[model samples]
Target: MDTASLKKEIIAYSKTIGIDKIGFASPSTFEEMKVRLYRQQELRYQSGFEEKDIEKRTEPSLIFDKPKSIISIALAYPSKMGPKVISKKGERRGIFSRASWGTDYHTVLRDRLKKLEEYIALKMPEARFKSMVDTGELVDRAVAERAGIGWSGKNCSIITPEFGSYVYLGEMITNIPFEPDHPMEDRCGSCNKCVDVCPTGALVQGGQLNAQKCIAFVTQTKGFLAEEFREKLGNRLYGCDTCQTVCPENKGKDFHFHTEMEPNPEIAKPLLKPLLSISNREFKEKFGHVSGSWRGKKPIQRNAIIALAHYRDETAIPELITVMKDDPRPVLRGTAAWALGKIGGQDALEALQHAFSVEKDEEVLQEIRKGLYFFAEKKQG
Candidate 1:
């Protein structure tokens, strides 16, 4: 295909395939990016992705054996639900993440990509194409930026002008040579709202994130919540959307991308009471397919207990007592004890003592005391 015609056909085909944005990138930029990536990883900024694989990620040969061009795609996750409503939907009334409030994007994006691939295959049967959606070792964010979609924001999320940082990215690496698009100019000149609003200070001052400090990462992590950070978590049952909410660039751009009329009010803003009483079967029935459900019912349940403590609502004491003993997971049991203590009062203190005897680990003992002190101070009252 001639350069002019190929670019036209690719752009036309990309829109037809349902991708919001499309761009081509020359293979050479991939090689240059590899070098820069190594330095970034050495500095400990890359999100816990295995840095040892950096060499393979930069190698164009690895991405496409005979690669000459890259086709980048963007899918927007615009939801009308405001930040406060979206975050609490699942556990409050019990719903899903705003992104998962509608159909799962994985299936939606893939179906569209399949159509793009079939068209390319028919156009040139000898040509080959491989598509990935947040799958594979390629530096996807870097590729998308180079492909001229958007620049990486201070929160480390790609920020598109039209959709802000709410767009999901995917790509198709191909052997077909297509004209490359110019990278977009960085527009986040001096904005730092995303950095300042981060609950755990994960977003650094200069557009990078320390993922370990990220509340989103910690919430999704399997296993125990560290003793030090437990109190800092607050009521976030799933991913923390604080950074995105604070971005000035995202203001007034309401684009809810679903046919659904409005967010399910039940999950949008719950009172942190019913979730503590949710049975495993009920938890599954409510949140199983949602994005936050992947960590299973345990983490969400554990978070609910923590939120009760953070909120300091004594009404949750009875429920907390039940979770402190009968909850199957020891970490949940331990957190429940800690939460109970934070709620204070005689009942909460007695439950902590009971939990302390059952808990063998010294770490849990420390948390138990932290909760117990609330009553110890109150006893002096």
Candidate 2:
């Protein structure tokens, strides 16, 4: 059978195995992406989590031997939860972004890619294939754009007409010389909503991001969040979706095709107070399966403290004091001290004063001073 016929069969089989969209591209070097990546590096705008080797990221031939074509796949995820966990006065909940809604996309997309590989192997026994999800050296969005799966959105996401920007992307590099799909035309003309609504001005322009200022990146860091970004974080525990949510193309684009991708409201948006004292074992039992939990409980817990402060939830003051006093991690202790000041009252003031006297870490001491300053400002007001 010719490669064209096999490509058609693969596309058909993909839908059967829960793959929503698939496109093929020439496995040539991503010349344009290489330039942008170098510029991003020069500006120091890259998130540290990304693959550092730009050559491996842009050159498919470096990672895959004898690469002839690349196949890009996308699976749409739900934008809204089914049963919402409402955030009220005392029971305020912190949210994980829609990307971290259900089971990890890495696991789900890899499963689909594995099935596709096995099917292709049966058809062409000599076909060689290498597959990868988000963490792979090859940039998934660039490949998806090249393969006509979607146009790269202003928000730096691949925006498929069918699923908008709420899609998980994966790719497979193969030795089979398949006809590549036509690339999609840019549809984000004259739209700057994503940039305008970015909480931290992280969207430097249409397609570029300063990852250091991005709340999505900030929430993943295991340190005291910069004072300026804490309030911007709002109630987000894992990732920020402001850019995607504000994009006009993503409006009303919610798809729940895979059951495994469906979110449990309680887990995706859990009460913030319970998280303050959750043991490592309990956190794993509850959030272990989700992609947001990949960085462990520290970032989440720290963000939850910031969220409580954002709400000015006086009820959480007791919990924040406990975290400040007893939590071993200085980031959490320092953040909780700052939060206590943000949620000022007699209790919070006393706690901050006590922490100031007892806290040994200079960073924690600095936070206690910041907390005390809030009270002084309030008194002058």
lDDT for each residue of candidate 2 in 1-381, tens digit (9 for 90 to 100): 899999999999999999999999999999999999999999999998999999999999999888999999999999988987789999999999999999999999999999999999999999999999979899899999999999998899999999999999999999999999999999999999999999999999999999989999999999888888997999999999999999889889999899999999999999999999999999999999999999999999999999999999999999999999999999999999999999999999999998898889999999999999999999999
Against the true structure, whose TM-score is highest? Answer: 2
lDDT of 1 at 157: 79
Tens digit of per-residue lDDT, candidate 1, span 271-371: 57678777779877766545567667777777777777777777778888887777666777778788887778788888888877887777667777777
lDDT of each: 0.72, 0.95
**Candidate achieving the largest lDDT:** 2
Q: Give the TM-score of candidate 2.
A: 0.99
Off by over 4 Å in 2: none
Clashes of each: 6, 0
> Candidate 1's error at 279, in angstroms?
5.1
